[model samples]
Target chain A: MVKLFAISVIRRPIDGPPDGRCVLLKGSYDLASFGFFQRASVKEFMSFSSQTIVERTSPATRQSVKEQEFFCHVYVRVDGLSVVLVSDIDYPSRVAHTLMTKVLDDFSSKFEWRSVGPEALDAYRDLDQTLAKYQNPREADALTRIQTELDETKIIMHNTIEAVLERGEKLDDLVAKSDNLSAQSKMFYKTAKKTNSCCNF
Target chain B: MSVIKKVHLKGIPFNILPETLLLAINMSPIGGDERNGSNFRKKVVIIDENVAELCDKILQNLSNTIDKDDLLDEFDIIPCESKLNQSPVIHDLTSHKVALESWCVPYLFKHSYHQFLWICRKSRKTSSTSSSSSTIQSSNSGPRRDSGNIASAKREKELSRKLSCLSESERISKGLLLSRALIIINPELTLAWNYRRDFFHPSSLEALEKEQRFVSLVMSRKPKCPEGFTYRKWLIKKALQKSLVEPSRIQDFISQEIDMIEQPIRSYSTNYHAWSYRFWLLELVLTYDKTVVSKDQKEIMLDRELQKSNTWIKSNVSDYSGCHYRQKLLDCMLNFCSDGIPLLLKELDENEKRIFIFEGHESLWHHRRTVILLSINHLKKCKDNNGSNAPLSSEEYGGLEALEKTFQDKESDLVQQIESKNYNDTENECSQLNFKLCQAHVKWMERRLKWDLTKSVHLEV
Candidate 1:
């Protein structure tokens, strides 16, 4: 079974300096995991994910990552807005990208880029229902099926989390640099490292 | 290998397998899975450690191979057996059925449901006790209470007593607390909101203010919920109704509502509900306390409203709802204008300026059409009244004629602008459509003017 956990849209700076901040316009997580994702830190993680995906992929390309048991797919539009879908590993990457594209198209048609905000997101709450509808792989649209077939030959799969990191860098560096990381996470990492290195209790 | 007679499974609960099989795959490995299989069945021989690992691997393979339905069918397990039994303990199965049932519900929902039930019971108990005490006291006061008049008097006393109890500030506060909790738990619960509404008097400004704050709280949680907006509107109407005695409060209350709407509109420009509520509010303020609101004050308010609408239209040129609202504002202005022609001309000038800037915007053009039609209608009315108190100086009369001539010129100018911009054919089609609409409007205006001229000529003859 394919389980969609969260979907988010982030607005990147268009034609500005590369280091400009990307704003998260709107996001919705599955109701079952809503509380877990509602925390500011988790939202920060989602934004970070979108930002990294945008930086990694060309405007026309899509990117996917396999982290632990979860799969994340990101599609970047030409206008610097990125739609990110995070789901269980069993979810088809092509379907996720297709869903992202559909959402991006629907959203842009209904609302102007300048008018996106928390209140604006209320108008698009039906997007959550779309997420729920596409959870079953059999319900994938024709475009999604075509993309899946094409992706079977050309898609690049990243089997490990390290695919997102630079050569000579570790996942720890990324986590440490992320502003979204809570203080508790840093302490936990330190304690875990210490426990692993030392045999004594 | 030895006979391995009657191998015993240890640690796992007797009901674990059945519960796991009955529930969906997502809810597998219920609570008992937390405890390792360390408890053994009574009177069984121990197996070798290697054999135990082998047994574990075989069971895991079986779980993966056989679906839940097939596994249950092969084991002769009944799905409803656990649910049918309400007992807390089952000795044969060692099942805590009640505990498991409670554990199945989500934590937040369970807690909120419990609180809701507790509040309901508490309120029921209080009402029952109050009613019983009131009856006992009324009976003890006089046996003649059986007569109709005496009974009504006794009932009146009881009602006053109950009102006095409810009127205590603490009682209202408690009701507020419970209602707030309930509303937060489920914003869609209209009954809870209604109960909360009873806690405040319609005329009490302080209570209305508190209710407004409470509404904001609920709105923050569910911004798009119509119920919250409807309640706020109802509150405003109630407050306004009570403010008739003190007309000064009406303006303040209306301004407060405007402030509430302004914030949301800044973020979501096309919120029709917010705009509709604003229109309703303006109507109330204009009509309410006509005796208290002086003519000068009404004019000032209308002018202020006109300026605000102008700003909104400039920012949201394509939002027809805002344009529609501007029509209403202009109508109000015309109704109370000392000299309607000059005001209409000024409005026409403003709208034309907007049209020149936003040439292809349909809503702006439509607004211009409404303004021109209303202006022409006003001029006709003025002529019928023998131009009494007319502000149409010769220069202004020339301006009005110039405005009408420019209306036709504007349409052709827009078509030329669209052509020069080198837009796609589909856009060309749309502009052509707009041009046709403008032509139709101008033709209608001309016919009305000709009809009026013929009537005047016949009258002269």
Candidate 2:
């Protein structure tokens, strides 16, 4: 049986069996992860595994998923609950490889979580690269909006400090004047640390 | 009693001079003359020979044709002859037949028969009394009064025509003739001086001199006359355009104009036009010297100027002319020294209220930029002379950084002053000072970028 792994995994009603239902997430590994499981009804798991080739790929997977990598939305009924696994049966083999790599990366890179084996890693890599290639504008737009918000908050903090100093007030008294500034500064410190790590490489 | 006076007796007149006969009327005078038949002697004046002849012929006929007895009994023939322009004058003689002897009267104007006829009727009521009033009244006629009135009107029209015959050149040559007349006629006419300036020809030095004189006169009359200020401005601008072509003539023009502008004491600071001319002069002087002026000498002059300007600003805070001078002085000072940043800051501090201060910090900033470049140049020069001796120490740069901070602080203060209008509206020092601040900011930024500080130094931005 084909399996997927994710940290912070949860189940929800499937909106569709195609591209929209196939959700993609990207972050530092500690933030979030995903996993997949096969149901008992899949009897031909061995044959499917033999047909699905395990592979590795470059991160710059600038292409769409091929048809052979699609996985079935397998339902597993436990007690009174029915859950559908989030993948398409018709996904290309390369997409299966990409998705599998993405799952293993989520587990090893951050908090310990269920690990997708080599076959699923190949599928995840394909899936992530495909999604990234198609969603360049949307990703860039979201990043810009967040950065503008951050810059405005930083300006406000700088102004408040300047005003306090100009008035000959002690810096310690600033907390009583503005809690927003203190919270924003904490956020800035965390982001700075993250940015430092990312930039160092 | 015969009222007429006649004397005919002569000694052997017919035998002595047979061809000539003279009959003379005789009177001693109106003053109690005694004329007993043979002793009477008088002369009667007649109008002229023509009137005298006619009177003589009628008298001879009256003697011969009338019977002597009848003439003697019915008519008292009083001899009368007319005299003109002599005292006690008789004007004409009148006669009638003996039956109408009551109508007979002496007519004074008998020399002309038509005048005699008019006088005869006029004398009828006046013969027994004095007659001069009636004769005086008749001689002055209606046409004479009409003619006199026409002549006066003609004389007035002729006088006006003569006045307008003169051209503008002639009128201006008359020396503030229009404005002076206007002052006399309408002293409140402000535009009279303006009209005089317009009528002045741009090309004529004579007209220019007249314009200057006209303005001078107006300003002399009322030192605060705005029209005088405007004309003075026009003269300066015209002079500038003329001087631009031949620079050698500029000195004379400026000297002449300086006298004109300086003459009015009250308007020295308050007159915008005069102040503008002064500012123009400083600009001209700066522009002329900029190319050839040496740095050390220029700095000394600039320092002197700044000191002089400080005194002026203290006395007359509204003097905007010094605005341009302070700006030029600052530029000259910065150009003079390599380490001029601190000096410039100190100078700016001295006259914190200089109009340039509140102006865009651009000029100040540009001056700062220049100082920075000069510092760099000085560094290069020192390196060229002795690489080891050159002061490339970062501590020196730190000192400059401190100076830069002072400049920024001063600029902020200037901006606040502009915002607050920390100046009397009567004196517009703050606005100009604001512009200098902006100019200083720009120049400082340019200098900072030039020093390659932007690349290595992380800006807070």
Candidate 3:
């Protein structure tokens, strides 16, 4: 719960749904409580995080996502390239935003807006390793934290999904209608929420 | 010699019997992508028997490696997966993606893998004189001695067959290491803890200290696990036996222990183990060994706890564990000081802003209910002390009258603000939850106030 669950870079179009299929790096997450099935809830959490980024309206905005116990932070640039960092709620916001801004800037400059090739990806300085490194922010953030003098200016720290959503839009209705999540994931969301089992999920 | 990464002694995930799952940790945050990482492996190959022997060997080797001067911070667990990280160094298993991929864990930690290797080789290598025998001894530490990692498929099959042939006594001999490994992997393994309980010599401070460090490592990964906390309590209980630890150092030892246990409570909320451990420890601190933990020292500890719980509650508006612990702390403090009443009032005053901001949180309301109940008890205490010779006049009573007036006024203001929200908007669910809880609090308070007036009147007559 203290670690970052997943990290992804998405390319959003002005009017259409965002293309978030580029790269998704997951960490060593525990789903031991699910017992029989995998708690790859982080995977579901990853999809949910990317979906939240896709739903954003602002050209350049910073927002927080509190879906159940998970806290996914998003930093969308004016260029439509957004970096998403999904972590446990206890993971600090300051470190998360700093890591995201650095990642987006680095990724934007190094590689063109095309999908990451294995060679192109390997060429970039640790887009993958940065995900693995920042899992324990206390240990890793000190060395890897970019010197982007971010002293908390304009990020809107929304408590829940509804806080960031447009007026009158329900999280449940959006989850039901979204094309990003598969039907099975959508149902699992409902069932997991109903049982209140999503905390570990 | 570098910083010790965490050791996540995890059991290999179920339904897969790969010899061991290798945890490759990056030396630098951004190393040659995958070429460089300290490698270690976790084995959950066979259940209840053969794997026990293998783990016992690795566990013995690992424990001995970690136990030398008890340098825990020197070891780290490997957090990166080996596949995506195709280290030319660990190239063989880099192709075997299924092993690490099938079993997914939440976080990555780094451990002292080289220590394990060094110890195994040292244990095997007596002198410069016979190096061949070293390979045989090293094999026991892992499935293969080639890289200090898991063996290949064909070798793994042969090893499991060989491990099954080991005698029960032989397995039990190294059971100390096996027990620790399994306990760290799956803390739910109660029998492992029970088996290891007698493993340490009672008189040896060194053994207990080593165990204290070991349990701390286990707790870093599994703080919610009861077995780790239970085992820690056992170790402390043993060490606390009159002559076991130095009498002067007992207080220092207990405070250090408190700092160790308190980390999990702050890092992860709703941790009853940390709070319960604190309560149990407090129960000991408050009552036990009067010479070292003096009366005034106990009062200081209670004051410190009140401040801690106050801050803890402010940040965690929804955590019931902190609130409940604060309740116990207040109850204990009342014996030492009458200021629990004012402290309770200050807590309510601080929470007023939080209550206004996060109206839907039930824990906030629940905490308010507890605070009011405690204040009422405190006032009753004041009245009892004053005696029934004359009426318990409001003017003479210490801040009770004003505290009640301030609380009631704040409650009405909160109610008015909550009522103004359009609860008819069915789209917003948390607001509905907030409204219901606020109404319940008001109802509960009205009932308590009525009880308070009647009881005081009865006492006066």
Candidate 4:
């Protein structure tokens, strides 16, 4: 079955880089195999990835990450409020970006994102429902149909997470250097990549 | 000393060469009783630059690791040059999920070469002789299982000395085992599949069952293998021709075949081989053994399959193969009986809702088109097969009028639905691809088939 694993609303401040403390985040981590630690590991990876991509993203621009068998889409509004969704490879990229945009527009309107801090904004529970509703991709049909008329070429496509990074920097070095990731999370990252590169389970 | 038992080898030419080399093989006895771990332990490695060495090395491991011996399950053929520092691995898919651990083989399969490697585990063993003096070598426990260290050239020469010293019949038996190993590693090797086929002569029920089990293990490793499915079909057809299975149990046999194929379909998305194999199985049931499977049973089985297809399509909405299959089932159902009209109506209703929700998918549209065409053809058949030149009574035309109303509603609402989706699009610049495709389907039905579902006159019987 197709899956939409995670969704988050991250704010990219005018600073060195956006922190991992996103205003809103929700995901389903049942796809991972590491018992008990699966959710946390998936959360860590998604947060780490979202923060990295959100920082690189400019205002009013959108980009997507197409990894091995999964895709991560990040669509940021002109106000710097970003929405990110990670789904399986077969999920339509256009529908995914459309969901992010529609959710961003609706979520931003309901809550005062500019004035509220991360703690206050976390009280908004619409993201969990949004992720569940859009997991089918059809639930967002009405909005996506309208989004189809827009110029899809405006969305940039990067084949790998490494492609979005600056030159001379590897993803491994970043994972090892990041203070936000725990030692176990980094170990999970290494093992997951190693096992997948040779023979996928 | 190896066991003193009768093992015959049907020989094949060993002159042809292989592309690459490095083989890691672990053999499990094909028969159920070959677990003594004492026979076939005389390892013979050959020192040659040709493919003959690969065969000799296979026999060495086959003897060293095979506790009992009939046939072994070959896992993978790893190319030796990658330097992965990993040995040949076997995934026990029967009981595990998200797991691909290397299983323990009594004898380690070690290949230190640059060309070809073969891996195996005993599915079953059939040898009765257990008088050998070799000790049971415990399998090493690790994430990966090494086949064994590179065979020493001196030991290989010593083992060959024994082979040269063997009786003439023993030499022939060894040749048969060598071909078996080679065929499993490369299932696509048709020449070898039929080569071993002539050797096995699987006419008896027991032998055919054993062969089926052996092929199933190979399929588990490679789920979408067309060759595997085709081989299975050949076996079943042979059985049917020979009347090996009872006629009463033929339905159960075909049902079992359908059950076996679902695994491959589930493992690999949009599996063409599995789906085609399914269609063939249904066709076989329809045509074969009609004496026992009454018309009612056939219809019942078809109805069940239609429901199964819809359930599968619901979960795997993106898989168009399932939709294609569902359409085939629809064709069979409608052609078999007129009760199919109501079921067709229910199916179109579900498809209509699905199209509205997932309009981005072309599969739903394609299936919907097939169903509409089928319904139009059904109506056309009714009108053409009029018993007399008189128009039908009101009751005779009621069911078809319902169908006509549905077609009219769909055609009229399609344009409105497309326009309502986007506010910026006007009538002149409307370029909704989904809507356009639906319109094309309607046009093709009227212009090509010459039977328009949207018109009431076409349904008058």
Better of 3 and 4 by DockQ: 4
lDDT of each: 0.54, 0.35, 0.56, 0.58
Off by over 4 Å in 3: A1-11, A15-52, A55-68, A73-201, B1-57, B68-173, B387-403, B420-432, B451-461
lDDT of 1 at B243: 62
Q: List per-candidate RMSD values in Å.
A: 22.3, 49.9, 14.7, 13.4
Local accuracy of candidate 2 as per-residue lDDT tens digits, A33-136: 11000111121221221111111111122112222222322211121111112222222222233333333344355532222323334333533443334222
Model 3 Cα lDDT, one tens digit per residue, B1-461: 22322222345322233424332221112323232122112222222233333233334434544454344421212222333212111101111111112112111111112222232233333332356555655456454455644434444455446444655445444455555655554556676677667445567666677778777766654566777789889989889873577877676677778877865565457998788898888778788667776888878777777787777776566688888998888778766664555566677777666665455677778878887777677667675777342223334443556656766666666666665663443444456666677677666766877523322121111
Compare candidates 2 and 3 on DockQ and give the better one.
3
Best by lDDT: 4
- Clash totals for all candidate models: 4, 75, 15, 27
Output the TM-score of candidate 1. Answer: 0.45
Kindly list the per-residue Cα lDDT of model 1 for residues B1-461, writing each as its tens digit: 21211112235432344343323322423343232211111112222233223223323222222221121111100111123212111111111010111111122222333333334434544565678555554444344345658644554454345334554465555455545544543467676677666555655676576566656544433444556678888888787666632675556667777776664454344566667777888787787667877666667777887888887776466677777888888878777775665666566666655544334456767787787677666655665676664444424646444545444454445435434443343333334554455455445545754422222122111
lDDT of 2 at B460: 23
Q: Estimate each model's TM-score.
A: 0.45, 0.28, 0.57, 0.60
Interface RMS for model 2: 64.4
Candidate 2: regions farther than 4 A off = A1-201, B1-162, B165-176, B180-217, B220-226, B237-246, B259-270, B285-307, B317-343, B352-400, B408-461
Score residue B389 of candidate 2 by CA lDDT: 43
List-wise, what DockQ does each model earn?
A: 0.02, 0.00, 0.05, 0.14
